[model samples]
Target chain A: MLELGPIFRALLRNKIGAILIAVQIAFTMAIIVNAVFIIYDRSQQTKRPSGIDEANTFYINSSGFGDDFDIKGTITRDLEAIRALPGVIDAVQINAIPISGSGWSMGLQTEAGAEHDGQGVAVYMVDEHGIKALDLELLAGENFAKSDIRWRGPAGSKWPAKVIVTEAMAKRLFPELSYSEAVGKTVYINNDEPMIITGIIDKLQAPWVGWDNLDNAMLSPEKMEFQSTRYLIRTVPGMRDQLMKTVEELLAENKSRVIDGMRSIDYVRERSYRGNTAMIKILTTVIVTLTVVTSLGIVGLASFSVNRRKKQIGIRRALGATKASILRYFMVENFLISASGVVLGAALTIALNMLLVSALSIPPLDWFYIPAGMLVLCLVGQAAVFGPAKKATEIAPATATRTV
Target chain B: MLTMTNVKKVFRTDLVETHALRDFNLQVDEGEFVAVTGPSGSGKTTFLNIAGMLETFNEGTYQLDGEDVSHLNDNQRSKLRNEKIGFIFQSYNLIPDLSLFDNVDVPLRYRGFDAKERKKRIEESLDIVGLANRMKHLPSQLSGGQQQRVAIARALAGNPRFLLADEPTGNLDSAMAQSVMELLKEINKKGTTIVMVTHDPQLATQATRNIFVKDGQVSEINDVVAMHVANG
Candidate 1:
């Protein structure tokens, strides 16, 4: 171990450059630690299971071109033709799929016109085949029977009295009861319409994955015939792409209706989280740039110090200090500076994480990242100072002593 | 004790090759205080550097303390230097950021001495230079004479077999120079060999022996007291 007193004294003599590099290290640590945490969180979120067969599924949105055409009849015919496609397994018309970032959301209340605001929940309208088509597991309850299915108009004039809810939504409405007990419970929508929960799914996510309550979703047995209708079709394994084109062409044959959009659920999900992916890219770029800049700063200051102390180094060499000793002196000095920076950076990291937590409601940064960040910065600092320290060792005691 | 036989040193640039030391030969016995004097660019400093093992000769043999060091690698030479040789410079060469004690501690640290031993040597060396109370003072805080004394303390801290001082008092006043000379004489009396290079003839007369260099070669050697008696 080196004697740190002399190194500290030397650094104190040149405090300005040392402080600047320290501050750079501190900010780099804070930004990188937090950025990495957020990126990891977002990446995990994107990979979360939507409780559906996403790989084998695609969605088609259609709208009739003319008013004289029967919207319900046209949707029925298009769904029939799509279901008959060779590779298609099952098809159902849904208002939206999870992770699309846009859908219908309403509140759920145990009693109508309660004084307190109700818990908000995403509302998905599907038919009797909606559960099987989306591959949702029925947990502690039965699937919706055909007699429970009903047609709901655009204004929701025809509302379903029976509804299927995810286990998360069930727990939210009746937190005092178990999953089985929450079944057959009455829930009010929009503070007026009463609906009874008839089935419970193990898991289903809301359209917006960033929502505070991502899993609070409910399924209604409504044959929704909107001006623009979305059909969620699940295909046999490894057959989605081939069937997507065939289905689109068959749906477009009517000529009275146009295929507004046709995309795999995977593509829709990716588009939904595009903002997060872009954020990761940008944060990664900033991290790389900051690390490079901080390293260069350390190299620049260390080189300057080495150049200014050439005579001193020569004197030390002449005094029987080996080349390794001279090199170690400089390295020890840099380590002192880097250690100071890391200590300050650890505090800064916590402060920055607290601010982000309060402002953005993100989870607090994990404590492990602090030491991990410090380790990286210290390694970078040492690596950056190595070149200048090596140069100091090359100073000849004879030549430098003669410089006077 | 030090010996050099037909040592040749050449400095080369793209356009010229300069022979800094050509067929240089010298030897100094143990416990002798020798002063070397020469005109500017006469290679006295070059010879001192080679003698200290701070520079390697292009050709020839050098033995320090009866060890053949002519073809030793850098690390081996460094080990030998650390074990046996100490150096002092014209400018004192004290690190400005270090206290006097730290300055003395440098070579001891390189020598891998324990802290207690290093502290004892540092204190004793500083007391020899009469700066024991000022161990905490930085080099920049000391006067030229005081700083040079601290340099001497640093050189003595390792208990080197011999000292190679190049113009040890070159940057001091006459009174300071005389004081430093007395200190060197006292150290020499204790049986430590010293080879000092200086341009002052008065200081040269104080040494037991003196050598003059010209054009990278020793032109003459004299016993200063004998020469004075012979002149009388």
Candidate 2:
């Protein structure tokens, strides 16, 4: 039988230590739950697919410096040579790589005029071979034809009439229509320039992984006529590393151009999400450290309580308390304290989550984390108090008769 | 109601072996109030502890209410102790944080009585000890005599077959000690057996029988009286 009534009354009289430990537990729970939630949230974000064959693709930047360097000619020649290599599948000169953390964005509206509300979209400048070179699955509409490809000079301002948008971008632009139905729709870029949505790709992330509209992107059918360009190359399975070296060497053969910043999509992704990875590691350490410190605090308090009540425990033992009963007594007492702490912790968890949601604009915490944290902390408390409580049982029943 | 035959208790340390009890023998019938007196280190307390089942005896055949308890496990001993034995300590060992009622409720709780039955027993025992009205007061709020009375109430709450008290009135004044002695006599009159160990010969004279212990064995009354006179 549990002596809950007597133990509770006893705690009521001597509660300063229990209250301090309980408050410590409450604060630890609040921080741990929130930190775990943030870690989960960030890890999920880092796992989002960038809609490319990341394992078999890479990109390299080439900049020609002298007057004899042919920007357009060199790009065209380099594409032909790279595509014709043994392991190369397809290649395209892209303006920006997906999830690379830097790119161009523009506003597209359904109707004309600057006063009309528009949605933001990251812009990828690729030619007719963009779909195969980037491994994009065209969900609806047709791919761009060779004749549809346009060349834009450094001083050019004309917008392409045909553009392909990702399914997410199509949904944002025309929420009333399905992705397939939005294929032939016309959207106005730069407020008034008419651009028709020629196709819808299944999934593609924008250049900025941290953006709220990470999946909202459009592919314009254009090749740059500038001094610097990046070539996105996709190789056959198990051939990316070999092709990366070959392509870098081939591009380096051009004396007027410098080949630099050659990287695979995997490296780009790692660099992009480094902040999130660091945050996860730091929060995990904090949670572990807080749990250890809180457990130690519980051990300290329980050991002190047992030491102070040695004579009382002996008297109880002499009165007929079995070892198991004595063990249960301390366990139940710790449970009551932990239960109170977790109850307060639940409120604090939700409150902290609310503040984070308002301040950081992240989603509100999931409801299940509160209960899970409470149970874990309770188990930790019970485990921590076991050693001291067991020591209490070792006190001789004869201690009650000792005058000292 | 209680018997011990050739009980031996040896206290061994790294460098010393002290015999607390050797070839100890004692028997007390039901409803008898027996007082044991001895000088310091005479093993009087050790005998009380062994009799109460608080400490185990080596090389002994012990019977309490006709049950052989020499080979009982610790848990079995604890159950028998809880069900059949009551103890009062020299210091009036009431848990300081618990009120009179709650302190008295400790053994009954271990006895597995329900709340109503426990409450009834607690009130009745406290009434017997003349502290029922002060049941809600903490032990620290009471005087020394009142605390000892609370301890007695706790011992009587379970209605055990025997009470083992080690110097029950050792910490009280003369008036309080006499009052507690009268209470014990009244309890003995009600047919509960009691075995008390004390150093006070005046207190020992009031028991139905008095036994003196010297050098871990019970000695004669004349020898204890002569030793008492010599010490004085």
Candidate 3:
């Protein structure tokens, strides 16, 4: 009601100051929004699923038992021993588990032609019953082979002749191909020899979450060497601690590997969370520091504009204008600066988001953030105006009357 | 109406004390055109500042339109000044960043008038100054005389009880100054009490009454007698 109302005109008056404010706001917003999304994703990764209970599971790095031991024999013997132990519910030997997100990558060049630049897919290898053990769903086709599986290739650097593909990979590699077409397709994976796709499994968990999932390739145990390191053991209620202690006792002679240093799948997943959390904190501190600096810059500029207008303000004051009216005038000017900065910053942020997605290969700017980002900028701009507006009011009308 | 009786204003710094106004007294009845003339350091501006409630005096009994202004706080003083006083300055002091209409509207905004009322007041004020068609033009686009007229319009828009002019025509050429002098005379005849401080002897004599300040106190001399007294 004093001259013009608060919102619209306030931001329209000060152009550069408003842009600086919005840039700061957008900077802070980019970090804050990115941080929140990262946290949410990490939480989703950490959330416990119903099938294989992580809390009641016992895992061991079997390769830690010795440098040159038969991993299969050791795994078979330990699993039996673990199952026989008190409170141990189930023991299974698995070649590789996927939930830790680390999947073994191999080449996938569409046997037709390797045309494009090196874009390769990964293939995961696991022994028999690993799927049932991890409680993963097989969307199409059967699991890996039940008998001995082997691939005789160059330097023996190969997995089994039978494989499984995740649904995402199935879509990418096959697309319109039926399960039966996919089952017999010679997929070039670990062995340099084409292996028949025995099953199609929806991606459960991998070393990374991705749509392409280059490591979406799967290998059965018949193709592996006689050794493996990791073991995923599921147990019944309340027997988790006892089961872990027994595994430690078994590896106690070799000691160091299984001591307090062994990392579980849960630890690995949380490591990713910690990684993103650090990112959030760093980016947030940077954006906040810059926002403070920008706000100070805007307020400084606004103060100058007000000081220069002192005589005019004094004239207005003498002409029956109240201090509140003068205060609103300066504040509205600041709002203009803020609003302009916000709009430009919004566009700038969107442009920056494009670079973030294209160059850095991070996610694009989510549309939901624009309005929220602007709101933050508007608030910051208003704050910048506060000191100067009050100063403008303190100017006396008699100041203009002086022959300056 | 404006009255000042035995007002004293002292300025002090660490160890130096200077008296700007000592035993200053003057009175302006309704509808009087009064000119205050003085040499530098004679305290004419200080008297105006005190009378306009722009500066505080160390000791005084001062009243404006029947209210005691000598003891008013900053806000109260501001309220009194806004409600009762209008000003025309030598420099015009028009807002460089605002248009003519907006410049006139600035004071009315302080008075908290609605848009329709403020617009009407602004147009009428500009019309009185013969610049109604040029309301959208900036002060920079106007000549000094025109800008000064806008300043007058600014003061007039508020419709204050009294008008204060500090060297209002000092910046204008002689021909423009006479026109402005005529404008002031006409405004005075319309019943707006005007207190003008001028250095021009001719302009000072044009007022109905004149006061000359010497050193730190008021000195009385006839309009013609004052010039000869200063010149001699």
Give each model a TM-score: 0.95, 0.97, 0.74
Clashing pairs in 2: none
What is the lDDT, from 0 to 100, of the residue A165 in candidate 1? 89
Q: Write the number of the candidate with greater TM-score, choosing between 2 and 3.
A: 2
Which stretches of model 2 miss by more than 4 angstroms? Answer: B221-232
Off by over 4 Å in 1: A65-68, A109-113, A157-159, A174-181, A192-194, B228-232
For lDDT, the strongest prediction is 2
- Lowest lDDT 10-residue stretch of candidate 3 chain A: A112-121
Best by DockQ: 2
Over B27-129, each residue of candidate 1 has an lDDT whose tens digit, in order, gives 9999999999999888988998888888988998898999889888877888788789878888888888888988899888888898999999999999999
Model 2 chain A: weakest 10-residue lDDT segment is A395-404
Model 3 residue runs over 4 Å out of place are A2-58, A64-73, A80-92, A97-99, A104-204, A210-225, A233-249, A252-261, A273-275, A350-366, B71-73, B221-232
Query: Candidates' DockQ values?
Result: 0.65, 0.79, 0.37
> Deviation in angstroms for A323 in model 3?
2.8
Q: How should the candidates be ordered by lDDT, best one leading? A: 2, 1, 3
In candidate 3, position A404 carries an lDDT of 68
